[model samples]
Target: MAELAKTSEAVHRDYTGAKIGMWLFLFTEILLFGGLFLVYAVYRTKHQADFHTAAAELSVAIGAANTMILLTSSLTMALAIAAIRRSAKTASIVFQSLTILFAVIFLVNKYFEWGAKIGHGLYPNSPELLAQSHGTILFYGLYYVMTGLHALHVLIGIGLLLTMLILTVRDRITNTDFVKLENSGLYWHLVDIVWIYLFPLLYLIT
Candidate 1:
């Protein structure tokens, strides 16, 4: 009985330590985005009317759908970690795959969104600058900067999920060593949270 208690305590300690480290990492991420947000705020203040006009051109429905997709992925990520810590390898793999699928779906939606916008002359330094309004161009610049950074994060997240998937399938992860899973999931959640702010800001700035 005491042996079992010792094992449980050790596992708890590992999980707790990993979670604390992840939180610290997230703090750094916050500062990274914080600088971007500061820049965005300055731009928005300088061009509120232009930002609103540009935001109006965006598809709010697609932005909302992407938000929900990411939120769902976050939930699956949580379950994946839970399954790993419980030693349910099959369940962990299934949840991890689901999380990846959702991440891909979000990416596809973003691709179409950006492609269509670019097709319509909505990108930084687009040729429309001479013929079109500057406000619209400014909006496109902000959109490109924000969404481009976000897409980079999403790509990183996909890689992280794939790694977790491999580790879960090979039985390399176990109840005693699920710290990596927790760490990756923390990063995944941070991506989702960042999008939560992005969705409303970009889709409904008006």
Candidate 2:
């Protein structure tokens, strides 16, 4: 009994350490995005008219749809973690699959969105965009950079969820050892939270 207690305590300590490390990494990500957002605010304040003009060019429907998709994915991710903690492997896999599907849907929407913009000659350094006011150019520049980075994070989150799915299927992540899924869930939630803010800022700028 004493040996089992010690083993459990050690696992608990390891899990705590891993959580601390993950949180520290997430903090760094926040700082990275924070700098971009600061630049965006400064530019937007200086060029409010151009910013609004450019923002009007964005598709609110697509942005809102992607927002809902990400929000749903976050829910599924949380459910996957909960299912794994309950030792419900099949349910966990299903939830993870749903999360991945939603992520892909978001990317597909983004692809069409960006493609439309490019088709209309709105991409960075494109003649149309360059001909626009400095504020319009800056808006699109920040839009591509910030949202592109967030999309990369979405791809990474999808990979992480897929890994969790594989591990769960292999019985490597179970009720007794599910920190991997939990951490992935945390990362996925962070991705969704970032998009939640991005949606309003980029799509609903008034």
Q: Over the stretch 40-134, how does candidate 1's per-residue lDDT look in tens digits?
A: 78878888888887788899999999999999999999999888778888998999999999999999999999999879875677677546676
The per-model lDDT (C-alpha) reads: 0.87, 0.92
- Positional deviation of 97 in candidate 2, in angstroms? 0.6
Compute the lDDT of residue 108 as modeled in candidate 2: 97
- Listed in order, each prediction's TM-score against the native is 0.89, 0.94
Q: What tens-digit string does per-residue lDDT give for candidate 2 at 10-103?
A: 6665888888888899999889988989999999999999999899999999999999999999999899888887888899999999999999
lDDT computed for candidate 1: 0.87
Report lDDT (Cα) of residue 196, candidate 2. Answer: 85
The worst-scoring run of ten residues by lDDT in candidate 1 lies at 129-138
Candidate 1 wrong stretches, greater than 4 Å: 1-14, 130-134
Best-matching candidate per lDDT: 2
